[model samples]
Target: MPRRVSLPSADDLFRPTSPDGSDRSPGEAAERPAEQAVDQPADQPVHGARPAPRRPSGRVRHDEKMTVYVTSEELHDLEQARLTLRRTGLTVDRGRLVRAAIALALAGYEQDGEDSALVQRLRDA
Candidate 1:
C-alpha cells in the first residue's frame, strides 16, 4: 500500500484567483458578462430595426469530419477549381471548395424546392 496524501477540497481547487487575493470562484467569474450576452439573441439589433441577414463567416471549426470518394476526373476538376481560386487570390483547400459548393447546392434547393439545380443534376444522373 502507498502512503495517503492530503489534497484541497473541490471548492478550493476550482476557485478563481484575483490579483488582490479575493475569494471569487470560477462560478462567479462565469456569471459576469455571459449572462447579459446569453439573455439577448445573437442576431437581434441592440437598438433599432432588425439587422440584415448574416452571411457565412467562412471560418472552418472542423467540429465534424466527413469522408468522400470521388473519381479521378472529379478529383482533377476539384484540384483545378482550387487552382483557379488561388489564381484569383482566394487561397483555400479543396475541402473548403467542396464545402462551399455543398452550401450553394443546399441554398439553391431551399430556394427553388423541386425546381432546384441540385434536384435536376441528381435526376440527370
Candidate 2:
C-alpha cells in the first residue's frame, strides 16, 4: 500500500513564524497608506456613494470532493500537451485544458442534437 501524506492547510502555509515560536495574525503583518486602507475615509466615496461592483469571487462555492483515475501514461500525455500549449504562447494547465475540452465536447453534443432538425428542414425543401 502507498503511504498516505496529509496536506497542510492554507493558514499553515502563510502563517508567520517567530524565532520563539509565536504566531502572528494576518492583519498584523503590515499597514498601507490611508488612501489604500479599505476602512479609511478617503478609500470610500463621498455622499455615501457605492464603489464600482466587483466580480463574484471565483472561489469554489461548495465543499465537494471528487476522485478521478488516470493512468501514468495518460498523465504524461496531459503534461506534454500542457507544455506544448505554453510554448505556443497560450498559458494553460492540465486541469484547465481538460475542463475546456469537456466544455467543447458538451457544446458539440448539444449541436449534434439540433442537427436532425436542420436535416429534416433541408429534406422538406
Candidate 3:
C-alpha cells in the first residue's frame, strides 16, 4: 500500500497573514484589518475599515489634426523605413515613425536647454 500525500493549491500558497497562525513570526501579523490598510498611513491611527475609493475612468477628447509637408525624397525614405520595420515583425506607419523621430529630436534639444550658452553667445552680437 502507498501513502497519500496532499499538495497545496496556489491560493493556499499565497494566503494572507493570519492573526493567530503559529507559522507567522512573533509580533509580525498585520496590525490593522486589510480594508483599513489604505486609509491609515504607517504613522497614523487606523480608523474603522472603509471601502476603497473608485478611480476615475481614463477617457479624453482627441479632436484635432494638422497637415504637414514633406519632400518626395523624404516621403520615399519614410516608406522604406516602414517596410523595413514590417520585415522585422514590427508594424508602424509613416505618421508614427515621424512622431517618434520628432520626440527623439525634442528630447535632445531639451537636454541642451532651450536657452543654451551657445545660443546666448550667438545672440549677444
Candidate 4:
C-alpha cells in the first residue's frame, strides 16, 4: 500500500498578513473583542489612496502573461534605453522598465487627471 502525502494549497502558499500588520502567528495575539484604538500618523492613507511603491528587485513574479507587439524602431529604442540604464549601474530587464513606466504614467494620471502627460500623449495620438 502507498502512503498519502498532504500538500499546501495556493491560498496557504500565499497567505496574507494580518490586519494589524504583525508577523505573529495566528492566535498568538488574542483577538480583540472590541475595536482597538490605534495611534496613526497624520499622513497615513485614508483607504482609497494607492499603496506605496514596492522595493526595486531585478526579478518580479508574474502569474498572468501578456503579449505586446512593438515595431522594429521601438524595439531598438527599448534596447538602447536598457543599455543606457545599465551604464547608470541600475540593472533591469525590459519588462521591469515597461512596468515602471506604466506605474509612473498611472500615478501621474491619478494625480492630475486630464492634465497628466499620459492623457496628453494619448489625446494627441
lDDT measured at residue 104 in model 2 versus the true structure, 0 to 100: 53
Q: List the residue pairs that clash in candidate 3.
A: none
What tens digits encode model 3's per-residue C-alpha lDDT throughout 1-125?
99999999998875644344323332444775677444544323237643333222122221345688988998999999999999999898776677676555544444465565544555795
Across residues 1-125, which tens digit of lDDT does each residue of candidate 2 receive? 99989999998886545444333444753654565445544324457575333222122222334567989998999899989989999887665677665555544444565565544556787
Off by over 4 Å in 2: 1-65, 114-125
Query: After TM-score superposition, what is the CA distance of residue 18 in candidate 3 from its true location, in Å?
Result: 40
Give the local distance difference test score of model 2: 0.58
Q: Which stretches of candidate 3 lie over 4 Å from their true place?
A: 1-62, 114-125
Stretches of candidate 1 exceeding 4 Å from the true structure: 1-57
Quantify all predictions' global Cα lDDT against the true fold: 0.71, 0.58, 0.58, 0.70
- Poorest 10 consecutive residues of model 3 by lDDT? 53-62
Which model, 1 or 4, shows the larger lDDT? 1
Q: How close is every model to the real structure, measured as TM-score?
A: 0.57, 0.40, 0.41, 0.57
User: For model 4, how does the per-residue alpha-carbon lDDT over 42-110 read when each residue is reduced to its tens digit?
Assistant: 334569876454333234345456899999999999989999999999888899888777778877776
Stronger candidate by TM-score (3 vs 4) = 4
